[model samples]
Target: MRATLIEVAPRDGFQPIGPFIPTDDKVSFVEAAHAAGLRRIEIGSFVNPAAVPQLRDTAEVLRRTAHLEGLDAQVLVPNARGVALALEAGAQHLAYVVSASEAHNRSNVRRDVATSIRDYGEIVAGLPAGLRLRLNLATSFDCPFDGRMEEDLVLSRLDALLAHREDVEVGLCDTTGRADPDHVFSLAAKCLARFGARTRWVFHGHDTYGLGLANVAAAWRAGITGFDAAFGGLGGCPFAPGATGNVATEDVAWMFRRMGVETGVDLDALLRLATRAAALPGASPGGRVRAALADRCAAA
Candidate 1:
């Protein structure tokens, strides 16, 4: 089976960089990623300019890429204000994230978990018809502030979110990249069993401990086909201390290619993109395949 890869370099990968990437270049990235066979891409987020100056040009980026055919442009919306901004920017797919760990949630969104969950329901109700929705449950297995989370607590919070909207695609996020593979599989299996009929599942992992690929395999074994990955592993939670970039998109694609599980992504094309991502000023890129094959590609 083929894995559905969502390219988030434009949003997740670009946000942490200190220097602001030009909007034209950001739109070009979305176009380039789509050309490489990724139909789904996180274009940008609708956050406050004072908070995230890098992505303040999200609406312009969205307007520029609106003409791309078959491109599923996703926008990350944190609250009702973000939702309104995203809708005004013409975002058709929305990714809403909240942390299950109370400490992490408080630190990340400046609110309690229950308050965030309640706001999510209000956000969903006000959305226009035919909009796609995805929910990312961050710190699903571990938290930077709270440490490792047990299954019951995670499930109980998930139960609450699903009650508000069960049809949205659910993402089990390894926000801190400190999750164990066995624990990942166990939680994913339970969620699928409990919510598979009503919703879809995806795994969003980071390679902080070099176990991102392993956790991805575990989730796949648990029957999840969708995944969120950033090129050159370009992402880190601003609120989660000690967390690193995400599971590199090229690394995940190569692993699946070797396993004969068609990834549908062009690895050579992905390498060139990764190289560009790695060169961005103030950007800390992470991925094995891009470096391992860089010399060979240059020599060839």
Candidate 2:
């Protein structure tokens, strides 16, 4: 079987890191990951620099690496202003994030879910043609403030968002990393059944409780092919309390490889990049395969 692994280490992984990664280094990481066979990569986000100081140079990074052939080069946008900044920087693919849990949404964006969805509708109205779109539904499975999210609530939120645009890729985020495989499978199944043919789907998971890969497998079984994983497992939600890094890209690739799935990612090259990510100043890296396979990859 075939699957897609969207590398988010640069955008999602680097956001919460305390030290500012040099612009040239960021560009190099994107380029290296592309060379390692990752066609789609979230370069960075178009948000307030004060909020996420590490990615302040996202536009520069995007511009520096935009020449990579066939690279999706995704940038995340939170509102209309972010959409403007991204488009101004010539971003072709934009991932817009909105929380499904109302309380978490308020805490993260200082607005209610209704207001965010309304903003998305307006964003869609003014968006230029030929620009690719993705919606990251944060806290779709669990929230630090509200606990486990209701499946119906998630579905309803999807219904509302898809109303504005159906030609989008939707990512269900386990923002708190408290989701079990059962919940992950059930909600993903529901989303696939309800909106499978309407829009593209992706699963963004975390390893806080060590269920990240298990949840990924569950989602994959439910027919979700695209997934978001950070190399070196370097990520967490600044707003979501107690959340940890994303499911490791190397770990996910390892699992799929053992199962005879094609990810188009070179694991040895990924291990090398992941080592660099782990060595970054102030980096709190997580993931199983990188540590276990280090000697093996080195000798190979």
Candidate 3:
């Protein structure tokens, strides 16, 4: 089966860079990705401007592109207030993050896992009709504060998220890049067994330990076809100390292209985007394929 890829460079990948992505360029990036065959993308986050200055113009950006066709523009909302902001901007798809480890959850969202889940439920309940919700269980594999996390804790959290709303899609986060193939297989098998066909699973993995691709392979074998990837491998977990960047969009696309699995993304275009993005004030992309792409571009 073909994998469904969500390009998150404009949001998850770009927000972590030193300087904020210019509003115009942010829109351009979104447009470029769409033109390159990425139908789904996380456009921005709706959080406190002080917390994530890069996403401060999320509303403005969304307002301008609200009429774009053939794109599922997603926004990340950290709380009910953020959800309200996203809804105000007409975001059709919303993503909420909750860490599986209690320490990470408290540090990241200032709430325990249970409270965060409850808050997400409240957020979803109040959204307008036709809006979709996706909950990303961050730190599902391990935590910086508490070290390795057990599969049971992650499963329990998934159960809570699924129980809250049957329509909610879930992404298992390998925050801190602590996941291996075995870990992915075990957690995914449990998720598939528990949620069965009711749940749609997406993998949100980090490349901290260089196991991102292996974990992706494991998830694919476990029946997951959707994944969250950052352009140029841009992004880091703010809550997890020493956590590395996310799985690179170009690297994963390159792998998929070579394997004959359709990701519906142009690897060459993605590398161009990554190379340019990496030139930004503090944007250092983590994709291994960027150097080669840069050389090719230079030669041309």
Best by lDDT: 2
Looking at model 3, the pairs that clash are none
List lDDT for all candidates, in order: 0.88, 0.92, 0.83
Which prediction has more favorable TM-score, 2 or 3?
Answer: 2
For candidate 2, the per-residue lDDT at 44 reads: 98
TM-score (C-alpha) between model 1 and the true structure: 0.97
Kindly give the stretch of ten consecutive residues in candidate 1 with the minimal lDDT sum: 291-300
Model 1, 138-248: lDDT tens digits are: 999999988999999999999999998899999999999998789889999999998767899999998899999999999989888998899888988887888889999
C-alpha TM-scores of all predictions = 0.97, 0.98, 0.95
Residue 275, candidate 1: C-alpha displacement in angstroms? 0.7
Q: Which stretches of candidate 2 lie over 4 Å from their true place?
A: 297-300
Candidate 2 residue 245 C-alpha distance from true site, Å: 0.6
- Per-residue lDDT of candidate 2, residues 1-300 (tens digit): 999999999998999899889999999999888988999999999998878889999999999997899999999998888899999999999999999999999988888999999999999988898989999999999999889899999999999999999878999999988999999999999988898687989999999999999999999999999999998999998899888899999999999999899999999999888888888998888999988988854522
1-300 per-residue lDDT for model 3 (tens digits): 599998887887776777767899988888777876888889899988887788899888787776668888889988888887888777889999998999998988888888998987787677788878888888888899898889887887877877778667789988889889998988888888888887789998889889888888899888889988887788886668888788988888888888889998877777777776666778866878887666643311
Error of 2 at 125 (Å): 1.4
